[model samples]
Target: MAGSKIVVRFAIIVAIFMMPSLLWAGAMEIESDRMVFQHKSERAEFISNVHLKRDDFELWCDKLLAYYKNSQLDHTEAFGHVRLAQKGITGSSDKAIFDQKNNRLTLIGNAVLEQDGSRITGETIIHDMRNEKTVVQPRKGGRTHMTIESDKAAGTPLPKAAK
Candidate 1:
């Protein structure tokens, strides 16, 4: 009886460790060449060709570190050729940090965001998902740049001028 009880407890612990995503609430999915999870720190590290998807949002990077709080995703840091896409917008950067609790994404190092033939480039870019706001910051001695393509240039019908 005592041995059976120990076996049951071990099986439960193994199941919890094996199905880490089951603890998360959303439909977030992650894939990578290799993954390591540290239960003590509540952290998971994904290495090599990491891909993450949640709803309409998708992210790709060479490596990603995900942190959890109370069995929920707290935040994530991505490194090496970070790329993100969501809601018709695409962005790239050398590194990125996503604060899940705050619904914010910060892109660092040669950050660029593009949509509908328009592009914004800067040293750092902050996207506030909850507020639908984006702010670009320039590196020291540099300037942020943006290019807005006109509707005519994009082959869209121009609005008629009021008479």
Candidate 2:
């Protein structure tokens, strides 16, 4: 009975501490298998199948490291099967870094971005969401790649082939 009471108390304490983070983005929530926070570094590391959710976007990764400034999200580094989703857009990469100072997201290793029917792929991609700009770069000696497909091309009825 005493052990169960202690567990309940600990659960309440954790919930209280996590409330502010959940409220950061109008009730944006983050969850993971484990989390470690370092006050001296002003950073928090979430490991194992991390998920982050908010009104405008969602992010998933195997691990995430968030650095805060003034108790606000300054930047983040996500590793292992990083994925980001927003309205009409989806992006994936092996690793991703969000640079708040530059207002850009840098994706590395088999990076890809897809919207509508078009797709952009490369070893590295830098996207500036505020400005709606993207720069794709090759890794080492590789080449950037893109495929643009029109909706009409796939949706239009084809003419019947003559016999």
Candidate 3:
């Protein structure tokens, strides 16, 4: 009877350890040409066609690094030709950061974000998925442009162009 109890206890421990992975089946995985993870306790390196996938978003870049503490993902950074795509929206930049808790994504260095038929280009970009909005700001001496072409105003009065 003692042997049976030991077996049951072992099974329970195994199941408990597996529960987290099963619950977060949608956790993001990143891949790229090169990747490096440096943490206080551990470090990892990766290479070749880096790609990251989560519940709804995917990222492809040249390199990526993930930091951790006590086994929790502290933060993640991607460098060199980073591209992020999700739900028909795509963004490109030199660097990108993903903040898990705040659920925020920030793209920097000559960033361009495109969604539907609209595109925003600037030196910095911030996307707040929780609020469904994006902010783009260009660098100094740069111009921000917004163009809308529609068929509804085929004969509408138009403003004269400044010469």
Q: Which candidate's lDDT is highest?
A: 1
Model 3 ranges with Cα > 4 A deviation: 1-25, 32-45, 149-163
Which scores better on TM-score, 1 or 3? 1
Better of 1 and 2 by lDDT: 1
In angstroms, how far off is 14's CA in candidate 3?
16
lDDT of 1: 0.82
Write the residue-wise lDDT of candidate 3 on 93-130 in tens digits. 99998776666789989888777567788888888878
Flag clash pairs in model 1: none
All models, RMSD in angstroms: 8.6, 6.4, 10.1
Q: Tell me the TM-score of model 2.
A: 0.75
Candidate 2 error regions (>4 Å)? 1-27, 153-163
Query: What's each prediction's TM-score?
Result: 0.80, 0.75, 0.68
Top-scoring candidate (TM-score): 1
- Quantify how close model 1 is to the true structure by its C-alpha RMSD in Å: 8.6
Sort order, TM-score high to low: 1, 2, 3
- Residue-level lDDT tens digits of model 1 in 91-136: 9999999999999999999999999889999999999989989999
Clashing pairs in 2: none
lDDT: worst 10-residue window of model 2: 2-11
lDDT of 2 by residue, 5-48 (tens): 11112122224544344334344467777777776666778788
What are the runs in model 1 whose C-alpha is more than 4 Å off?
Answer: 1-15, 18-24, 153-163
